[model samples]
Target: MRTTDFDYFLPEECIAQRPAKPRDSSRLLVFNRDDDHVEHRIFHQLPDYLNANDVLVLNETRVIPARLKAQKIPGGGRAEVLLLHRLGDMTWEVMVGGGGLKPGKKLQIINGPQAQIREDLGGPRRVIVFSEAITPMLDRLGEMPLPPYIHTPLEENSEYQTTFARHPGSAAAPTAGLHFTPNTIAAIEDKGVRIAKITLHVGLDTFVPVREDDPNKHPIHSEWCHVPLDVVQAIKTAKEAGGKVVAAGTTTVRALETAAHTSSHQNIPEFEGPTSLYILPGFDFRVVDAMLTNFHLPRSTLLMMVSAFASKEQILQLYKMATIEGYRFYSFGDAMLIL
Candidate 1:
């Protein structure tokens, strides 16, 4: 499919620059595929729509402060780097910005602290070797890498992360999880709905645009995910008890599905590794009965993945409804629950 096929008009003002005052105060657009129904609701009312016999699978991956400002060696030219992911012990992949800086050049974050560019693989990426541990260097200089479309500067650092964020590795937050507060989580549990957690450290690739006309032609970036056997057992038990496997975010869906794909039995084994699984339309879902996700960018792989899980035509119609209803869009925006 052409990238344009997924296009839609979004008012620039609808892009959320900051999160809603109270986290759960954000708007919620409920999409019920079972009956072809749509409802405009608030995020706090989410549990009211959900039954007790559901399992909410959430991604616990936390967003790290990855954006860094630096300077070129000797020339002292200004430069900025966004850490994508660690490649190895000393090598790291980064997205650099600012005017032309040739390959084999070195960038110093602070005076006398330089990272040598080992190679330039083209695009916004380069392989660099820092003077010391990549973590420590990032700890010293990195700022939170907010999405490009968000116009306002991030005033408070903590707002970029979810209230329940525990694992600090992802470049981006599993935004759907951001809507839930500790009280809301307890409310969901008080209703008898079970909660489970999985980890998929989201990378900068989550924001990479779909450049291919055919969605299948897009190469998905590999992300590390861990699905513990305990989560697998919880989900299996929930399913056995006639409960729905509801994923809190796309990352949770990916991790659970990847586990089911490689599981020896019907349950996922505890393991840690990388997954490049690109979930588009026509893909049979072995796990995940429903999804709770945020409004996605137009023509993004995220839109395609959800369209694949639900009905494409239904998603498109709902998106049009959302736009008409003046719903906020993108990360730090409102949410949709496809049930």
Candidate 2:
């Protein structure tokens, strides 16, 4: 399909600059696929729609403080680096924003160690080798890589992270999970809905829009993900009990579907690796029966994914309705539940 088909008009005021005060207080738009009905409610009321037999899968991948300020060693020009993936203890694949960041160029981190460009991976991507392991110093040297649309700075680093975040790797937070707080999760668990955790380290590519005329020609980047045996067992139990598999975000959908995609048998196996599964329209969904996600940008892969889960026309109409209803959009925005 044409990438232009996914494009829509979004007013600048609709973009959320800050998260909801209590996290769970954010608005939620629920769409029932069976009845073609819709309901607008608070995110804290999510448990009302969940059944006791359902399994809610959440992505526990934490967002890293990936953005770093630096200066050229010899010329002293300012630069910025965004860590995308860790290659080793002292090496990372990053996106550099500066001139002359080519191989062999040295840069001094603002308050961290020295780094050298090892290789250029075309465009803004480069392999950087640091003087020492930068992971430990990231807290002091790096800043959260918030989306460019979020003009207001976060009051705290944890503002961008989900309350259940554990394993640190993702460059961006799973916005759908961001709506959950301890109380919200407690209420869901108290309803007897099983909670399962998976991980898919989000990359910046998730926010990148498809530039190609045909979306099929877009190069989707692979993200590291894991679908553990426990999660597989949880899904099996939920399905056997006639329960739905409710994915927290598109990342969770990708991870679970990737596990199913790679399996040779009817059941999904434990998977741990990078997944490049693109959920275009007409894709056969084997795992997820419901989804909770944020309003994505127009022409974005995230939007395309939800379109695949539902239909492009329906999703577009819902988005337009949400806009008219004054629902916030993008990261740190309100959420939508599709079932």
Against the hidden reference, what TM-scores do the models get? 0.95, 0.99
Q: Write the per-residue lDDT of candidate 1 for residues 1-339, one digit (tens) a residue.
A: 676777777888788888987889999988888898888999898898667778888888888888888888868899988888788876788888877656778888863357888878788788888887768656556788888887788778778888878887888889898898888888899999988889999987888889888878888899999998779888888888888899998999889888888766766566579998888888878888889999888888898889988877788888888888888888889999998
Q: Write down the worst ten-residue block by lDDT for model 2.
A: 261-270
Cα lDDT of candidate 1 equals 0.84
**Alpha-carbon deviation at 193 in model 1, angstroms:** 1.8
Worst 10 residues of 1 by lDDT: 132-141
Best by lDDT: 2
| C-alpha-based local distance difference test score of model 2 | 0.96
In the range 222-243, model 2's lDDT, one tens digit per residue, is 9999999999999999999999
Local distance difference test, per candidate? 0.84, 0.96
Q: Give the TM-score of candidate 2.
A: 0.99
Tell me the alpha-carbon RMSD of every candidate. 1.7, 0.7
* Stretches > 4 Å off in candidate 2: none
